[model samples]
Target: MDLMFLRATLLFILGVYANSLAVAKFIATSGRHKVKVICFSKTGERAAPFIRQAAKDYFSEASFAYVLWREIDMAFWWNMFGVDSAPSVVFLKDIYSKPITYSGSFNHLQLVKMMDDYKKNDIPQLRLVSSMELGCDARGYSRSGNETVTWYCLILVGRAGHAMTQMRETLRRASDVLMVGDDSDYARNVNLSVAIVASAAMKENRLTFTWLDGEVQQKYCQFHLAPEYHTKSCGPSYEDGVDAPQILIVRYLRNLTDDNAKNDRWKHFRNQYLGDTKVASQLIARYPGPEDVEELIQWISHIVERGDTREFPYFTFETPDLVPEDKQSMGSPVGQSFSRGINNRLKKLHMYISDLPRDPRVGPSLLLAACLLFGTIWLQNNRTKQANNTPGDLASSTSSRGRARARPARTDDVPPSMTDEEPKDAYQWVTTDSDSE
Candidate 1:
């Protein structure tokens, strides 16, 4: 009977375990981007409605799920998925990797603010192109044979300073135009490749943008450019030979699986323009303004259609030098003193709260604790003193009472002589007056 009951119980537990696994798997696989809100059992019930509602309102694009804090098997999650917090939100973009965790309580406003920037977490930015990964063997070019897609890369090569800073901003401005389509039908077609991929339907960009650090990549940069316009030769002037920023466009051709008869199947295109002048001239017709980025996009589109320029790979156009001026003074004493004051205040605050007695929250409790401690010590001391006096008092009471005296009786007695010693065993007999009769 015992064994039969045990078997039935085991079967029920197994069913429950299997059901839980199924539920967890279903939740994991339900969405491209999953937001799992975790809270304690009591808090979970209260937060559940708000979480669901806010998730819909703020993160309408993502699928949301909820898990009780107790149900989150922290030991398993810590080892398998690296999750170890409650009252937290985890974003699981791809199910294979550990999710990004955002901990603590968040209201609607805070939640929206935190999540707005993260919605585009999957979008690709114009990152730095790696020459080593691409096997370009040269800077200012990305011609990796391993690439599955062709890339028309706009590369800015320069020392990392104020000038490169402007270039980075320009790339961002240009990307805004090139990565999305305007409302017009013609504009949409022009940016069709980018738009199609923006929705995540496509995996690669038809045209990409990136930059290279010239200071570190000087050797490779020199080899890629014409000998006359090398880093050592071209700068502010011919005499100085200082390194200056240059912009170049490289076209990498896709690798063919099977060779077929075609015009230069493996040909790579490059247009290395010297100085900021030629690049800026093509980008900005007159003075550099906000619209220059738009003009630059048009020029890039035209170049993509024009094919490789065989006549002159290198072009130099004379335009005003586009170096940005730094107007602010290097340092300010007032700013330094303000910073120092803030630091000193932080240090003082840290020191003040470093001990239990000093913290404002601990004041009342600490006083109570001190009083209890002294009270206990006083009680113990009194107890010890009383215990020590107890035995002494009892001994004095016994000593105060003299030895009891035996009452004398009238007796016929034999007295021992002074000169004679009494026998050790001899006893004297006394007769009482009452016994005399």
Candidate 2:
């Protein structure tokens, strides 16, 4: 009877311990219980009560709150949103999640519509796409292939305007994922992701329609670029050009501007750096062939299509998907394909234009500097290695390290040579004071 009672007690205790451990583990791995949203306002009171109710009613699992900032926290804010603006709400599990942000104030109905959209979290698997950590800017030159891709959750392609619509459509299609569009959450919602795509230009407005009586602006038009390009002085609107009907990249560029003057800077970068004549020349030098453009385009198509989806992303807009097929691996064909992408944008033209300009501020210069810096580091490493091999030091240091944990020699194991002095005439050949080496 006593033995049975003891056994039963032990069994009960074991079950209780196992249950407690399981509960503890569940809490540790599952993450935050309540969503923590941050609503931002420069206008203050106009957004107070609505902010509170949004958090309480919708994100009951989230700890929703408002953060009024006269001076936006660029350091933390942009990282939270792809870019930051006022009267915004961010929704997500926590700031650590880098939740999504939607900008601007809205009426009760507008707010509800926006919230309904925010709750629709897509991109279920927040792929690394890049190996970078949380806050690095995946967009600029720093995110070249060699830099060990940093914290890029997603990387969008194409600049703003119609491209934005295309990209947004793509995101919507990817059911299980959410992407970043700005530095902070648009509002305090916390379920979306944080990111932003820089705006450049659209050749000065391509869409025109007469609406609302006398000339209403239809910036809302989507397909700005024709499917292909032709060579001519095709102006912004169809009425501007009749003979030379071409896809004016100029108009596409003009469409990229915004209140921030980003379109101008982007154009400056594109013309001086991205569309340089010299870069194209260098490419021709490298991959001079009759069918180079065709080959190059195929290569890029393959790589871009696969994207960096296999690995973590390095930047917000730069997907790690495979490059064009020819540029699939960094093998010769793929490498040449990349060269073509850089230099061959205007390959069909007689005037060989480089994607990068001669100006110094261009990204190529920065890229070159980085390459040189890395080369210098490699040279430094080689120099250090050569210096260490100063006749006999290399072998000695390596051997010494190898022997660090070796067992000590016992008295009985001592060799006769080490234990006793050498004979006076050992190997005293030829009677020379200075022996021939």
Candidate 3:
């Protein structure tokens, strides 16, 4: 019985731990919960009642109540949301992603109001499409209208609010993901131009954005909607209240009024549905939910970047599901193409070096020149050494010759005073001296 109880306890703990991990992952990826206020011990206990009251008062349906700091992992928040300080308020659009963080203590009412305002502010009103106006001027750079007519244009046609608002918010957030807060000059200028195809534009060129009213432009709506719904018309007067907005892109040509001009340029002005799963897959490699604005904008940017005016002037946005024959791996072709070009250049360089020694005249001339240079240097060094030794050699030779001549001739070679004479004369001389004395 004891063993069984112990086993059950351990199993229960393991299950709880596994469930917690799964929940954490979901919270990190999906922004389901609205508010996650963290406070520690005494401070959290004191603020709990007020935090609950605030949620109850304003955001009862949407808000998450205060959580004890000990119960929540600080490192997770730090890594995910860049939140390090305690007693912080996290306002989320997508709880699984980065949230708007408020560090330190704050009033409950103010917190509630801030969250409420953030939700309300997400709706995007239609900005007038003109050659004179620019979309998304948050960073500043005005665009003209005439410039967009010649390039691809993404226009959201619908009534303001509801689905339109969600789409617009998604488009805006997509820029944040693609741009990633780049402040460099090139990124700012180039990416801004490409990204604004679905968000903003200048009258200068390339891509642009605009919207149309569903009720006001019924004919235009019906023309785009009929093919998708297989209906004769669309708008408020339609048989069903399926009054959803639609997205379309237009491509225009330049300086040609000939018959082939229509075939070349105007053929790509056809509408492409933004809600298509295949289209979304082209942008982020996964299907984005309706509220996934960031994913949607990235998709638009992908198509705009690949668009070529000379060839097609628009993007096919074809994915594997729609056209399996055209499907390709997710890796970019740019890197592979660049590597192949570099390899070709290196091979040419190797061939050029290998052929250098094959030039008959050049090889012989260089070798002969090198030999002559070495001979000249050797002759010069020999001459310098001989010149330096000339005086010392002469002096040494002169002293040696003088010492030989100064020595006396050998007297040993002279006859020894006729030594052949006998010694009898010496005895006779001694006797004469004695007689004289």
Candidate 4:
């Protein structure tokens, strides 16, 4: 009775442990774009109520999970993400990237601020994967779709610094001002040209706002800026001071008269063959005015007006592609196709393989199976050799060889007799031995 009770207790404990592992894995993988917050605690202890409230408030922006700390997984958590102890929190922006971890306790305000910071950036950085989704790449259509032929991309390029942050905030405010209705205070305060441009841009969804890292994308920044300003604006900072962020606004124009179906087919062909070519002719102009919000807004409004109304020389050039923030998130054609066909089977196989090391029976069972297989193969080979070397088989083979060697030659099997001398012509005969020709 005691033995049975011990076995039941052990099984229940193992079941609970396995369930915790499954829950942890599900939490890690389920949310793709949203921020993932994992709270770790002792088995009986619960996380702060504010953490749960934050998760509820930011449900749309983030995913939250609670993991019970186990001694067995202590090293895994510590080495993989620096979670050294219980009562800790981990914030994951994406599955592939390293997570941000906090070991100490925090209040509700701090927790909320952290969640807000992790959910999304104030102004998103332009990247290869995001360029397509945001419709900022020349190869992609505008946010308003194919009908919108003329669109603008406003980019603020700079390395990470106080100046870059301030300029980014100013740009964000400008974009916000444009996004709002004309009745807003920002619209009323702006000049007539600025108001008109903002209203038109808002209505048509013709403008996209993004930022680029100048230090990382030096070539791209230099390509957009004039040769003289390249040193001033792009690359690493000099001993003098940090480089001020510069604004670049590009006006893209796609041919509207072409057939839509033909264009689509050609676009697909170009994507497959020509790679990341320029699908639109663009006019690029750098902002020369001060970084003040009002002045920046005025300059942008003027540029938009000119791009929309005035005729400019249209040019096509290859632009550098933005680097991907998360390489694992990018999709491959073969990977997508394979996933679509065998996703479920692959998941099951992956789970089974992952569990193999954990399950105590797997190792011994595999070893036993291997031994059985080897023994069976060895016995079969031994039987085959023994059968071939049997006395009756060997004697029969030797007798057959002896008969072949002792057999006499037959006339039927031999060709007609022929001399080993030169051949005779039709009119002459060749002599053999003593005969003359």
Name the better of 2 and 4 by TM-score.
4
**lDDT of every model, 2 decimals:** 0.47, 0.36, 0.46, 0.70
Q: In model 4, which range of ten residues has the least summed lDDT?
A: 268-277
Q: What are the per-residue Cα lDDT tens digits for candidate 4 across 200-270?
A: 77567788888877876788888888877766678888888657788998888875433232435445433
Candidates' TM-scores?
0.29, 0.22, 0.28, 0.50
Locate the minimum summed-lDDT window of 10 residues in model 1: 268-277
Arranged by TM-score with the best first, the candidates are 4, 1, 3, 2
Residue-by-residue lDDT tens digits, candidate 2, 115-154: 6676454322111111122111122211223222211222
Residues 1-437, candidate 1: write the lDDT tens digits.
99999997787667557646854775555432234433323254555566667756634245565666544255544554455766666665343433566777777766666566554443222212223233221222233232233345566666644555565566655665554446545445454443323222112343555555455445544544566556532232344455455556654442232212133322211111111121111211111224345456655655555433322233333322111111122135455435544653554344334433633556787789999999999999999988787897777766665332344554558676775887888889976897677
RMSD of 3: 27.8
| Ranked by lDDT, top first | 4, 1, 3, 2
TM-score, predicted candidate 1 vs. hidden true structure: 0.29
Query: What lDDT would candidate 1 get against the real structure?
Result: 0.47
